[model samples]
Target: MSYRHTLTAFILAAVITPGAHAQSFDPGSMKTPDGQPDISGTFTFRTLTPFQRPQALADKVALDTEEAAQFEASERIRLNRDLFDPESG
Candidate 1:
């Protein structure tokens, strides 16, 4: 009797487990009716605004367009100064 009960429980669990946790993927979820991947919007993921200003530019609250451009150019030059220097190890 105990063996019969154990067999029944095992069979029930085997039958019920897969459907209980099954997930179906819909390929049309992020696609248009024309079958193209629908990525239609302007995303401001990368903005020109800085998250946190550095302590060196602390006193300056904001920079005009040309001032900001020059600042960025100088920063890039300062950072990549040793790019082509052979002895900059």
Candidate 2:
């Protein structure tokens, strides 16, 4: 209503208003100093569990102690089967 009230309201609005500053760039317009396209480095990624488990074991979430031991034993047997088999020509 009054000049002082209007000035105070303007100042309060300026202070309380949400403001952000960000930059936008065109990917095609970017270039390296050597006149080549800017590129990122290579990366390697790994995960502990397989994406899909066998259908027989679908109902299990995590391996129990005994189950883990059994799985490890089976894996070792498979891995060492050729080493133990001596019938090769």
Candidate 3:
């Protein structure tokens, strides 16, 4: 009932309450309002870059301008439909 105890309890509840009912979003299958899965995104050029840093670049934390250009070109090639196997599509 004291001011200190009430203030401490309120602060603790305020911090912990939101986490107690946390909602997680799985982006892998993000859905739409009508219940259909949503696949559309803002960007169209889906690059083929690895989510994790490549083993080849493990020792290099950041890329220089030249290296970045090379990486971008390689990704473009990877995402190019002409380079993909025709039989698969």
| Index of the highest-TM-score prediction | 3
For residues 1-89, write the lDDT of model 3, one tens digit per residue. Answer: 69999999999999998887685556655778777888787864465667789787899978999999888777676667587665863
Off by over 4 Å in 3: 1-49, 81-89
lDDT of 2 by residue, 1-60 (tens): 699999999998787664422345567666787779976667543433435686767898
Q: Is candidate 1 or candidate 3 better by TM-score?
A: 3
- In candidate 2, where is summed lDDT lowest over 10 consecutive residues? 43-52
lDDT (C-alpha, whole model) for all candidates: 0.76, 0.67, 0.78
- Candidate 1 residue lDDT tens string, 1-89: 99999999999999998977676567688798888998888866245445678787899878889989988766665666767453743
Residue 47 CA error for candidate 1 (Å)? Answer: 10
Better of 2 and 3 by TM-score: 3
TM-score of each: 0.32, 0.34, 0.38
The C-alpha stretches of model 1 lying farther than 4 A from their native spots are 1-52, 84-89
lDDT for model 3, on a 0 to 1 scale?
A: 0.78
Candidate 1 has its poorest 10 consecutive residues by lDDT at 43-52
